[model samples]
Target: MRTIQLKKILNEHCIQFIEKKQMDLSLSIEDANSSLHSASNSTAGDKHDTSRAMMHLEIEKKSKQLNEVVQLKKLIPILIDNSQQKSFGVGTVVETNAGSFYMSFNAGKKEIEGQSFTFISLASPLAQAFKNNLNKKEFQFMQKTYTILKTF
Candidate 1:
């Protein structure tokens, strides 16, 4: 399997996730704004004030989520760096007894063409284990032993 092709697939998945999250956050923010505007014109006294406060909280929460999604988008290129695959680092695909992993983001397991690829960050436990012991035959993780078959 080509590592470049695998990286492209993983990047596509990450982009799709970012797009979906952006759309969801946008909708949430719009809804919160609408509610806040409605609360402003209402004359329910204490109830209206409470509703306005709640809408403000919702907008704040959605704003934070949007910020996080934007940061993830910025990290995409850095996550999939096209560097030399000397050892298990960023942009490298590691094949182990546990599974095939694209060291990118912690987006969890992604199955493409019937094969499973667990996208993990370099700071993750599994990636840390594969750090210095690149070509080693076996290693232990969570009390379970795993063999490093190949890395690219």
Candidate 2:
């Protein structure tokens, strides 16, 4: 497949993942809210207090996670701009002797069109190593030398 097509596919996948995360987090938050409500109605004093506290904490944590997902959702569109892919940076697909990677965000490994591409974040150590070897087409990680096959 063409690099841009694959990139677009990966971008779509990222969006899907983000949407699923948002939905899941929202559901968890709702569940915690319901639990908090139930806990508030309980007659047991100390036990009710502890359950309410736990539910509040859970809601707070889920809200923070949802906010992070929102921020990540905002990043997806900006990061997927169809500019030239020339270097080891975001919005580029890099293939190395070790494996193929799509440098966007750490979406983990995905099998698309029967090929495995590890979606990685630019801030990742592997991406940093790739950037350091951009010109050389080779890098060393974990004591094993890997060569850059292509970038798109």
Candidate 3:
């Protein structure tokens, strides 16, 4: 399959992943709230207070995580919008001597259309190397030199 098609598939996979994470975190927060309610209804006790406090912290943490996931889900399409690139940009994949990387999110590897693609954040060291050297075909990261064979 072409890189454009494969990138679209990768984008869909990333969306699915974000949705799953958001759902899981939401459920966790709900469960924690329920536990907190149950703990509060019980008689005042040191253990119960501590349990409630812990549940409150858990709920807060999960809610923050869910918010971050929602932002990331919104960003995926904007970053990988299938626009034509003059040089390597947000929606392009950089193929190097080391491996193939999708310039989207750090969603790990997925095999789509018989091609393996590693979704990486632009802030990542490897992606940074590519982003900085968009004009050049060669760059070094982690003591290894990577030569960009092509961009998709």
Best by lDDT: 2
* CA lDDT, candidate 1, residue 32: 90
lDDT (CA) for every model shown?
Answer: 0.81, 0.82, 0.81
Overlapping backbone residue pairs in candidate 3 total: 0
| Tens digits of lDDT, candidate 1, 11-124 | 888778788888999999998999899889878788789889989999999999999889888877775665345655777778788888887767778898888888887888
- Candidate 2 off by > 4 Å: none
Q: Write the per-residue lDDT of candidate 2 for residues 1-152, one digit (tens) a residue.
A: 87667788888888888899999999999988988887787797887788888889889999999999998888786667742556557787788888788877777788988878898888999888888888999767889998999888
| Top-scoring candidate (TM-score) | 2
lDDT of 3 at 23: 90
Sliding window of 10 residues with minimal summed lDDT for model 2: 81-90
Q: Give the TM-score of candidate 2.
A: 0.91
For model 3 the TM-score comes to 0.88
Q: What value does the lDDT take at residue 28 in candidate 3?
A: 93
Clash counts for all predictions: 0, 0, 0
